[model samples]
Target: MKNILRTAGVLAVASASVLTGVTAAQAAPSCSTARVCLYDDYWFTGTPRSFGWVTYNVGVDSNDKGSSLVIGPATDPASPYVYFYVDNNFAGNNVVFRAGNASNDLRGLYMTPTRNWDDEITSVWG
Candidate 1:
């Protein structure tokens, strides 16, 4: 799902066949290259769940719960965007982020006119 997007702070989204969830209270991981990491809270704090290429549902533990995001360089330069969705099965409103981007706070990125990307993501892909 595509919506009106904000240009500042350079936010990120998600997608992956392989995703890793870290403890929410734990500090964020390095995030590495060719990966997208979604944080439980703003400023890359709290829990962090990282992902690679392919689509994902974000699981029950992390669905609609992301507050920030970090993206690594794309493995495939031709497909360098990460996608975050508002609905399951890769449906509903969505945000697409470029590789190597990071957002300290997803709250500032608009997913819809009145709603921001923070805590509104249900699915993801790159």
Candidate 2:
């Protein structure tokens, strides 16, 4: 009886642990922490590109091509955020996103007072 009880307790703990791990995995973004991930399509679908802490021009694989994005916590959590620019070299109109934020699409994001961000991102600061 003792052996059976101990085994049941162990199995219960193991099952709980496994379920917790699955929930965490499902909640996590596809990209790593401290990086910004850009998606080619809405709802984080399509090709993905990740950027670390730096200001860079979006090039071949992702230039003026981002339709959605996920911003993860920065290396320093307190300063977690990224900026998307309308023109290269981080110039022109821009929009900001804080850590852990994801946009399904850019079609409704304001790049400037006069422009939308969808498919017009030329640079980024992460």
Candidate 3:
């Protein structure tokens, strides 16, 4: 009886640990911490391009292809804002996203009244 009780307790603890891990995994974002991740599809469904505290043009392949983005903590504490630019080298129209925020869809985001951000992002900086 004593051995059985001990085994049951151990199993219960193990089960609880597994449940906790699963919950954490589901809640965590697909992107890593302290980096911005831009997705090609709405709702962050597509493979993301991650960026640190540098300027990236995203090249032609990723240019004008961003539809959503996830913002993480800044690489440096001083700069906690992320910028998405319509032109390379951080030029042209831009949008800002703060730390710990995310834009699941970019269709509704407009850099200007006439220009939507859905597929106009060509570069990123944070």
Each model's TM-score, in the order given? 0.72, 0.70, 0.71
Q: Judged by TM-score, which candidate is best? A: 1
Tens-digit per-residue lDDT, 1-126, candidate 1? 144354221232221212433233333345777777888888787888876656468788888888988888888889888888899878988888888777778889997689998898887787
lDDT of 2 by residue, 14-119 (tens): 7876887543323336567777788888767778888774656768778888888888766787677788788878888878888888887788887556777888
lDDT score for residue 9 of model 1: 18
**What lDDT score goes with residue 87 in model 3?**
90
Candidate 3 positional error at 124, Å: 1.6
**Candidate 1 off by > 4 Å:** 1-29
Off by over 4 Å in 3: 1-30
Q: Give the Cα-based TM-score of candidate 3 against the true structure.
A: 0.71
**Model 2 misplacement above 4 A:** 1-28
- Give the true-structure RMSD of model 1: 14.8
Best-to-worst order by lDDT is 3, 2, 1
